[model samples]
Target: MKMRKARTPIIGKLPLRKGTIGFRLFLYTEASKRSAEVKKYAKASRIIIYFIDRSPHLVTGNNIELISLQFLHRQSFTEKIEQLSEEYDILAIVGTVQFEYNDIPYFSLIDIFNDDHLKKLNSIICKDEPYSEMIQTLENHLTMVPSVSRLVQRLRKVIVNLELQLNVNLKEDIVIGMILHMAFLVENMKLQQPGRIFPNMEEYYNSHKEEIAKVKEVLKDIEIEYDIKLTDGEIAYICQMCLENQQL
Candidate 1:
């Protein structure tokens, strides 16, 4: 996240520790004046992206702290990346910014690496170019908040569908929470078997019958689309979310 004055690499990779959920941005440029001499220096670095979930860390660490520690020890950061590639899932490769290769998906530096917004890290080094925001957006995608994660890509459909079905224009956090809740429902609906009673649903149904009805309609549509039936209790649970999202 810290900027180096020397024009080394214009694109910045994600600043992440071991066991974190994100990726490293590797830059590739068609050999220009600065990089023409370096061996294996294509225009851009082929990035093998990965994401892993772990127990949350304290939100107090800075990206530079890790880099400074690595500098002090004179450790090879590339070696660490190799180790991690073996340890975790390699999600995908980031193809060129403009071209859509047959195998690799393209990513843009302006969205993922910029400093103006979505600051998972406190800083971004656009000394010439930046890549952190790009990786953070990818992280959001892997985390199921695809609206922020992919930056106006396929998740826009998910947003539009949810809004249309549920009849609410959700704020970002609510959208995230709703998707996560849906994920949980999908995972556990079979085990939980959905007949267990929660009194909150009854209160919600009594007070907000209209939203409760909307939840049933939406859930029916979801069942038809996804080919999975949600129990009445599940419908009620999401109906409660509808009420909450409306308040937000």
Candidate 2:
């Protein structure tokens, strides 16, 4: 008798686009004069400069490619912050050297934007910041091995917890928000343990088979909501093998 196998369900692929990730740097300077020098070296595919003051605001154009040295230190940091309330296609934040202010640090705001741009924003911001090494380590973990199943499971848990804590229903925004938040959390985690050994693709999969299977189930339910269909059986096979290996 042929053994009946579970028919793997087909689901849609998660959308990923450039600029989905972003980094926000808070540089600490005695005054705008000293901060100007640091800003001069900043470069990326996209760039923005803002002063961190009572209210943050954008001082540079959205399309500018290179860091605007002229805009640096021209206005007080407080003035730049005022502009932060305005929305942009890309992520925005006041440039600063200090990571914290008055004993309060900025919480991870990765959930603020769409997925396609979020990753790109994270990469550009991290590369240009003083914490480049730290950021690099974080990136390494996030990019180490792509296990969509594990990623989906972990993300689901995070979004659920976030919803509970915030007392706000973010069901509509959970998927994209979770992806960005996971990237940031992973980055920050690696920064805390630069020498940490990130789980290998095989290892991660083997350890999380059950969780991954559940993710597959969820994906089937939400397949239509995504932009691409993920009907690849190979991916599911790999995830299963990883989980099986972990048990041995």
Candidate 3:
């Protein structure tokens, strides 16, 4: 008798290409004197802040580099855009109203500036809900910078405590929580210095073995219930792989 061959499962390709959403932000001020004034204050304070949540991918690369040159000596916005367009594949440009500068609030920049221009910028940069939410969240949170760090620390502690109380394994919930925590921290760090190193999963796990073991045990129970044959590490790795693929 002839044996039947098992059919291979076909994987569907994702529609979005990797790195296609890449963008560069150009902050175009009106004049040289104004640009110099802004730069001087920014340097002295060592804090360049915006309410908009600019993507780290764009801010760290050639996008910022080209814009910085134009802003350094007060070149025209047109010149800055020209230079940036030449260097990178600019997906969009956004114009943000400086509602606050160095903690001094300015409420009328949006009204004073060209609303149509701002709208055009918004149309280009605004892609997904997450992107819009991130920007709005950043803007709201910027006003509370005095409590931001402490608030984040407290939230992380609360999440960790909840994980313990729920008897949720550190390898799964705790590790995932820490990953999110680190991502936030990295994003904060990048606001100051672009392209800073972020925390690694292996390093985080190695430092918290006891917690990881607890997570592993809980995951084991879950695996048994689901009839999944994967080890804890394998499960985590698969999750990460799936997330990475989805982002592309």
**Number of the predicted model whose lDDT against the real structure is largest:** 1
lDDT digits (tens) for residues 5-118 of candidate 3: 212212112223333333333333322357666665454222222423343322332222223232333235446554544444333222233321111111222421344333
Candidate 2's C-alpha lDDT?
Answer: 0.33
TM-scores of all models?
0.34, 0.20, 0.23
| Per-residue lDDT of model 2, residues 1-248, tens digit only | 12122122221122223333222233222223565554443531123322222112211111212212123443554444434212211122223332222111222332323343333233223322233333345445565323333333334433333332222343233334445544444434334533223346457557656655554543442233222233334235423332333311
Candidate 1 TM-score, C-alpha based: 0.34
Off by over 4 Å in 2: 1-75, 87-90, 94-96, 99-248
Per-residue error for 246 in candidate 2, Å, reads: 17
RMSD of 2: 19.8
Q: Model 1 over residues 99-122: C-alpha lDDT tens digits?
A: 321112223433334332212211
Best by TM-score: 1
